[model samples]
Target chain A: MTKYSPPLAERIARGIGHLMFLLGGTWGVFIALPVSVAIAADPIQLAIWGVFMGSGVVAAFAAWRGLYLIEYATIPAMAAGTLIYVAAITNVVATGENPGSGLALFLMIALFSYLTARWFSLNQLLDGPLKLLFKRRQGLDE
Target chain B: MSIGTVITLIAAVLGSSTLAAIITAFVNSKRNKSQSETEARAQYTVEFNAIVAQQNIQIERLEKRVNQLEKAEDYIDVLIAGITNGTIPPIPPRI
Candidate 1:
């Protein structure tokens, strides 16, 4: 009989990655607002903040989906989402709303999402148990 | 908070978030490098196993061919020995 092995590193990496994404979302919503409010942007700027915050929510959802599905989906989705976000922020900047704030928020979200996604993907790739799971799923001998 | 206060607050928030993100990216990248190395090692082990299996098959096939050739040589030697000893000479009158 063949022995079975598990991918421990990969699993731990994925769990940590998802947890980061979840926390990133939490920071965007609750922490960001109060921080922005304390500094005092105009109504239009506040609206921009809301938009940035909305994008963060979308990113978090996509990352969560990756965690459950492909283990690598988070990276691509987050990257694409960040590109879209940068574009959105660029438009807002052109409109003469406190562009710096929007750009800063965009950068932060992009960095967080990218890091989280990468962590998960790499973790899964290195996991011994995960490899066995994949082989088993394909009906190959372990 | 006054409008100016709010604007300042937003700036501060954005700045802090950016700092946090940069720090996170740095940490994550470090971890990612190690993970990628591990994955490569695992992949290499599988490939090594496959190569070994193929080599085993080839060796087995070559050994079989050698065995067959040895048997043919033995038979030829026996025929030659019989002929030299005159025990199995070429007979012309039997026909």
Candidate 2:
């Protein structure tokens, strides 16, 4: 039998996944950490950010190790991150401050979450309950 | 609704649509990859079967030739033995 090579699109998708891991890890370490420290974020905010960053780190490690189920952890982490962004923006608005930066951060988080989620879903990183849920949703749609 | 609320709403809409597009592309690519892989496997199988059949035919022809050679050798041995024992009349010596 001849050796099988993955299609170009498949390779590109995997490359994107690797890029996401590198960027997410780097952002968590450099950008998020320094910014949080500079702003003197409170314990709760720091903890939330920690969870978000930690999730990316964990998901990246899981992806590297081929632990698909653990990779799903990023979905909830992104959800929490999105919620925090909303809260931060609302607080800024309440304090009569410009929320442009907060809004931008929120959008960025949302976009990242979307890309990550789609990557995992398409790559078959989900199984068990998540797989069943997707099948059921498709069944309902049909 | 406040401006913040309006912007958030818009962002949510944009995020969801972008997500949908990404999902569609991913699913399509994955499906295409699987279909191509299956096709490749099927083609490989067909080719493999054809080669095996050709080899089998060649082997069968070789076996038949071997059997004919063996029978000819045995008949020649028997004729030599008959002449040596003089059990069958041998050809007369040329005058």
Candidate 3:
């Protein structure tokens, strides 16, 4: 009868998903920020980091602005964007250089990840899969 | 990187993101609007059929009544012909 009434198992699954996401996002920032700050030293590196991380920032901004469709775009953007940044970070660490702007850039990464995950969770709430499951369960119960 | 390069890169990234967001949003909104419109149209059709069915029932009932009235009128005409031909004695009226 209600539009949304997910069962306990589904709720638990969602909760676990969220917990992992939180741990990943939080720890990633904590770890990467120091790493970024340590590695980033040159203006060229800063600009590169900024350009890459800016994609996620834009996604986070869109999510923050409540642009639903555009927000999902963060997924691919983050994928490609994060890959470049991580590679750059690895290069810096390999060269024994500290990326001073790592924190600034990775901060955007954290925000983008957090927002996109929230967006996905919200989408799951409106998903028809749960509704179908509920119907099947109801039929069995009856 | 030069300040110009930084600004250009920033502009490129931001510009692309803004464009992507706008296009995605526009396409999705249009799709949602179309889906809802289709649902509305289907709902309207169902309602229209229901109203037409109701009207049809009324019309059928009216047609039956008309058919009965025609039969009754024919019987009355036969009775009047009998009276005019004097084949049956007219019942005396009680004044």
Candidate 4:
């Protein structure tokens, strides 16, 4: 019997998904929450940070269980984080302050978002169109 | 550069790179599948040729055996005629 091996893209995507889970967990629990508390952020700001924290917990759980939910949970958080970082950068620039840190954070979030999106897209393709195409081709060959 | 310009540039770079990565992955996956299929077909062809070769060898052996059997039968027919016409002596009875 032939050994079942996943495609290269799928292997890459799974690696990215696991990385996202780790990054999301770190960002939510260690970075976002502590920073919000240290800054004595307002309720609205705290809630925004809470989203990251929640996403991180979900990502960790999904990763632990080896579920696809990691991709779903992290992508939205990364997207929201990217937007928040952009806004923070603009605010810093308006105050005549160096926006370097904000920009760096923004870059990180943007990169994570891109990776999560790629993972999601690749998984979708593998399960849907690619599988369908392979099935149809097999049928035709038969 | 202004903050807006920098942000725009970053967005454009990220967007284009993401699109390119996905498209490349899709194309590469298709190429990988086709390559595997070609390899499997080549392997199967090699196996089939080996089987055919083995069968041919067996058939040649069978054909040789059949020729030997036919020649033996012809010799037996000639001996039977000689014995019946008394041109060749038959085996003596054992005591």
Tell me the tens digit of each residue's lDDT in model 2 across A6-114.
4555544544554464465356546764432223345544554455544555555544444333344344454444444445555554555654566665675676677
TM-score of chain A of each: 0.34, 0.48, 0.35, 0.48
Point to the candidate with the largest TM-score: 2
The DockQ for candidate 2, computed on C-alphas, is 0.01
Q: Write the per-residue lDDT of candidate 1 for residues B1-95, one digit (tens) a residue.
A: 44444344544555454444444444444443333333444765777899999999999999999998997777777778879998974543311
Cα-lDDT of candidate 3: 0.49
- Is 1 or 4 the stronger prediction by DockQ? 1
Q: Is candidate 1 or candidate 2 better by TM-score?
A: 2
User: Candidate 4's residue-wise lDDT over A1-142, tens digit each?
Assistant: 1222334455455555545644754565466643323233345554554454345455444434433323333545544445444544555645556545565656756765675665565344233345657878999999
Cα lDDT of model 3 by residue, A100-122, tens digit: 54564566567457645654543
| Candidate 4 lDDT | 0.51
Docking class of 1: incorrect
Ranking by DockQ: 1, 3, 4, 2
Q: lDDT score, residue A100, model 3?
A: 59
lDDT of 4 by residue, B63-89 (tens): 999998997777777778888898875
Cα TM-score of candidate 3:
0.30
Of candidate 3 chain A, the 10-residue stretch with the lowest lDDT total is A1-10
In model 4, the Cα lDDT at residue A96 comes to 55
Q: Write the per-residue lDDT of candidate 2 for residues B1-95, one digit (tens) a residue.
A: 54334434534554454355345434444433323333434555676899999999999999999998997777777778888898965643422
Please estimate how well model 2 matches the true structure, expressed as its whole-model Cα lDDT.
0.51
Q: Candidate 4, which CAPRI tier?
A: incorrect
